[model samples]
Target: MISRLITILQESELLLSDQEIESFSEVQPLLNDEDIADALWLASKIGSAYKVSEPAAIKAVSESDDAIAIEVIDDNTVVVAPSPMVSAYMPPAAKSDNGSMETPELGLPIQVQAAPALAHPREISRSLRPLLRKVPSLTRSELDESATVNRIAERGIWLPILKPSPERWFDLELVIEASKFSFIWQETLDEFQQLLEGQGAFRNVRTWTVKEAATGQPQLVAKRQQGTGIEQDQPLRSPKELVDASGRRLVLFLSDCRSRLWQQGQIHDWLTLWSQHGPAAIVQLLPERLWSQSELDVGFAVQVGSLMPGAPNSKLQIRELPARTEIAPADTLTVPLVTLTAEALKQWALVVAAAGRQRSPARLFDLSWVSDPERDQAMAVIQPQSAKERVELFMATASLLAQRLACMMAAVPVELPVVHLIQQELLPEVQSVHIAEVYTSSLLEEVRPNRGRL
Candidate 1:
């Protein structure tokens, strides 16, 4: 029944956060689906009975961009976001014997539980900043002739402190996943989405949700108001449509990876396509401990050779390699699974920023996931390690543009634009020493497909 309810939320386009999902998972058994839905909708909003002790705190938290996703409710308060989208789809509640509407009582009451872990998912979502903000941020500095001449004439200085023309980058696309029938869990989720947009450090954040369609295919959805004056779902976009060929867009998919569509491999195909074209990663909706239970661990976890804000390697080699005797190479795609925690996002920023660059041992997402039921949640294919190790594992798989820049400079067939891309895009590029080492290694192979560029 709980599983069925989860399915409802996913199908209804109500995005719930990890904490909310956990709350529902532990809910006491419901008499039926309608009761669960009514209980959830009314519990957070039952007049004074459901009101918080600190209404000002609620207002302040709602107004605060930083405080949005964190846990603010006490034992007495059941704070759920009211979603017309949820109410529209949920079954109507049954009335009592007297024909008066029966009030639904919540199955989940606040209780003492295990101590909070070091990493809180809600707090992490509110605070995690993207380390790699834009991909290949291109720019050119032009001399400000008027200012420069004036300065030279007035103060006898030659520095232009040039005016830079940066390329208009793509917006950050935040994708979230909900289950089949979990409309009741949308409260904290709306706040979580707002947090990502408000505090995620991206200039523009476009959130698109992934949900299981009635046909059982997972789809990309947008909300639109119809001519009749009611909000309705727009036509679904195929997951492949999310790809940006310029490798500019930074795509973040937030999911617990428990949807049937996820386990069915439909989600995996598009994720591969997204990573290949540009920077993309799953902002894991599950806590770290339960990663093995989901589809996150299907890939072999080899340490990558290199990453960004760091020099690229010449023919990178993965270290401390785990032997995957049974895992086939063709089945793996290097899609990063990242938690919303600070350190994890830091590493993910580096790894994903380097997605889709040419490398020796293939590239990240080279070995895509083949979700196996036997292996599903049985054990994590990619185990938790230090952020450095995570980055190394990712880059060992192959760092993208960073390694490319190193290769270009190493071979000495450097284009001004490519160098500028690194210097401009990667503002704090790697040190001269690293570039010098690439030159010193004598490891780069020069290829001349066309003599003009060479």
Candidate 2:
């Protein structure tokens, strides 16, 4: 193995960079020189993982990324990589209710669990129907005006400061944990449609033509509503439009909640229809997560003099007041720079909001819906803090989602499952450093109808 791997590495040396060679060398000392063949093979594989110029692909498999695929050859001889698109192996730490475990013959045992893991499927689903009906109805009612005002008043002064206080930090962590259900456990509607198509609930899923604004060429948009017998004279501009169209796929494209559009009469109308005449599924892929901030900001303080044209020494200074008394002088705190512009303030607001979401439980989750034109089918982009938290939320989301879905699908004679993809990142504009898909479930088996007495 050592001789063959060495030969392969020597042949691929031209493709491999010096930095990659160094990375492999760091791992080599832990391996036995006698068993150098396996070490060489591991090193060569890792070296090949790094493309010459492709940063995205490189970042995906890097050691720093939340590596779903990991092999522990030994403590020091661990091999790790990004999770593959599909695998036969059950995710790591996958616990079946029956306490049965299956190990595939080909590879190592995986450590990740799939999403939507539910215990009491029937009772949960039944309870969720009322809220599924109520929230949307309230959003659409004439009382929406008062509801919005009341909601804002109820969530008074939730945003935290740039530097979190001890109490605020504890609150943020709780909120992040609670809101992980929306962020971590999600999937594309198209993927879910595929599962339903197999179950015969959804048939004849087809793509439609929508001309791109930038290029006159047609863009392929999945129009699953085609065979569902819902017709519209004009294209659906919003979810409110879907109500009149009476389509199976009434996707409320709420991309942002902070905007005024979400609070409008259209959202109210859309929600009313959703509650009254339910769709087969209400899969909200994008939950109001920490990463829901419109702007990504990393705050910095620069001296007022640093902004002057031709100022060679452009460095930041933490403005501190001189101590009035000898004892108090040493305890003086650094003041916020006054020179910060409106853009900087806006940036700071996003940072604070993001931080507060991660730190403060006092900050309420924004459940309002906003309009988006890009996505035709459902898609979710999750940003949970950890893999374990993501897995827990995935199951909770499935259980919660199953109940709502049960209400929607109750009208339909056919038993339809609420499928969650859990892995795909629908939004590319989000520049998240650490994120991963924890799991996907069709919810068919997990959310089975009550076999015994209700």
Candidate 3:
């Protein structure tokens, strides 16, 4: 019965077939249905160990019988299924208490229903099983259509393009005029070129051209053209075409030319040379002109009467008057004045020294003394009068120096005001004079011959 069951499974392409049963029966003639069932169950168990279904195990065993099936060489020497196990095969069913259906290898009864057989046999292999289980088969046209849809969805969109700009269209020009003349003119083109090359601010200048003008040429003399947009092969105007219209020789200097020249290479050395030798060189080049102008003299006078002590008893007299030398436009002078009482002068020799030190070309004026008749009377009335009856006399002298400053400058006036002299502790007594006002007048005055002079 097991052999017939195997044949049915093998032929039906289901759980067991007739061909597999016949092949197994041929291998062992004495083997009963129980042993055959056991072998089929072992194959199913191997398939189950690999997570394969019963139908897959059955198909695998039938297709590769040498790896999955038990064989018989002769009746007495039957060959059992190769061990350590061959390939994976189907597992057996368990036995149930009622004995209706059971797979002993799985410890449970088989539950799968068998598939119907067709006239033609369907070949089973490991490669054909998975496709047979899910898709059965696929067409090339359908696979291509699916791939095309996937590619279209994965790609991005296209964008618009921009145009490029044209290469050429505009021109520029610089117009220069050469008619203007500079103070320090360069005589020749070579000289001008050398000057431009020297340095400072004029180093990079290459702009202007110079030429001479004919007598009958138009007043508008020279013109300068800029090279900013000109072609490399374009012809330029000759030096003769550019000229200074005025009859005098003309020289042109472009703005910033001199400054640029001063700033170029070796400028520091050039500047040092100029600083050390330039001024003297210029003085030698240009000498000062002589003056033929005449000179004029002016007169100034100061009053001498202010130096007197009291009211005059006689007319005033003019003694020797001081004379001052004429001064240049830029000079300064100082004058000194001195004053003291007769008793103070007799007590202090410093007072006299001070007067002598301050003396100038000026003269000393003497004033009439106030006479004491009583002192003269005492000298007559008593034989050897006491010193107490002697008269006390006070006198003061002042020395003045006239100073002239600068030929164009006039002398500034100074005033003298009367002031008392005071003595500080341990210090010599000194008289102080204050200046009150100043006036202008002649220094010479006429007076009686016998009058006291100050």
- Candidate 2 structure lDDT: 0.29
Q: For this target, which candidate reaches the highest TM-score against the unseen true structure?
A: 1
Q: Which stretches of candidate 2 lie over 4 Å from their true place?
A: 1-187, 201-234, 237-265, 279-282, 286-454
Question: Could you tell me every candidate's TM-score relative to the true structure?
Answer: 0.44, 0.19, 0.10
> Candidates 2 and 3: which is better by TM-score?
2
All models: lDDT? 0.52, 0.29, 0.24
Candidates sorted by lDDT, descending order?
1, 2, 3
Query: Any runs in candidate 1 off by more than 4 Å, and if so which?
Result: 1-164, 167-170, 180-185, 223-231, 301-306, 309-321, 324-330, 350-454
lDDT by residue for model 1 (313-406), tens: 2223344346554545455455555664555665555443454441212123323334555545555356436656744543453324345556
Candidates by TM-score, descending order: 1, 2, 3
Residue 149: error of model 3 in Å?
51
Best by lDDT: 1
Q: Worst ten-residue run, lDDT, model 1?
A: 358-367
Better of 1 and 2 by TM-score: 1
